[model samples]
Target: MKAILLIGHGSRAKEAKDVFIKVSNGLQERVKSKVYIAFMENATPSIEDAFVSIREDGVRYVDVLPYFLFEGIHIKEDIPEILREMKEKYDVEIEFKRPIEYHELIIDILIDRLKGAGICI
Candidate 1:
């Protein structure tokens, strides 16, 4: 089976974690495939742990979606390295997707946020 692993750069703040979980939950509901969430650090259910759970569920493939905004070290180096190890260890097909880079929708969202803030954008 195939699954989705949404990776978030976890924060020490509870609110950050809460928001990630909320997004994950919403994604889970909208998608037919199994969806799981993990954090890079400062959070529970690390990527490795999530992989173990996914493997246990007999998921043969995983799409690793990084919930990040840029191609930082974490997106370029850290995540790919970890995913390589996980793929070998779990014997599963893993695809590391790009981060949330520039997109027209992002501009729309920014404009909406500015308007919501009464900035008259």
Candidate 2:
């Protein structure tokens, strides 16, 4: 079976982690495939832990969706390296989805936020 692992750069704030989990749960309800959430640091359910859970569910393939906005060091180096290790250790096929970078929808959202803030944009 296939699963989607949403990876977020963990924050020290509890609300950040909670938001990630909430988003993951909402995604689980919307999609047919299994959904899971993991953090890079400062949080529980690390990437490997999530992989173990996925393996337990007999999910052989995982789509790693990084909840990052740009191709930072985590997206460029750290995440891929960790995923490579996880792939070998768990014996699961892993594929990465690109970070959210430069999309028209993002611009639309920014404009909406600005308008909501009474920026008159």
Number of the top lDDT candidate = 1
In model 1, pairs of residues that clash are none
- RMSD of each candidate? 0.9, 1.1
Tens-place lDDT digits, model 1, residues 1-121? 9999999999999999999999999999999899999999999789999999999999999999999999999998998999999999999999898899999999999999999999975
Model 2, span 2-50: residue lDDT tens: 9999999999999998898898999999999999899999998899999
lDDT of each model, Cα atoms only? 0.95, 0.94
Tell me which residue pairs clash in candidate 2: none
For the record, the alpha-carbon RMSD of candidate 1 to the native fold, in angstroms, is 0.9
Compute each candidate's TM-score over C-alphas: 0.96, 0.94
Worst 10 residues of 2 by lDDT: 112-121
Candidate 2 whole-model C-alpha lDDT, 0 to 1: 0.94
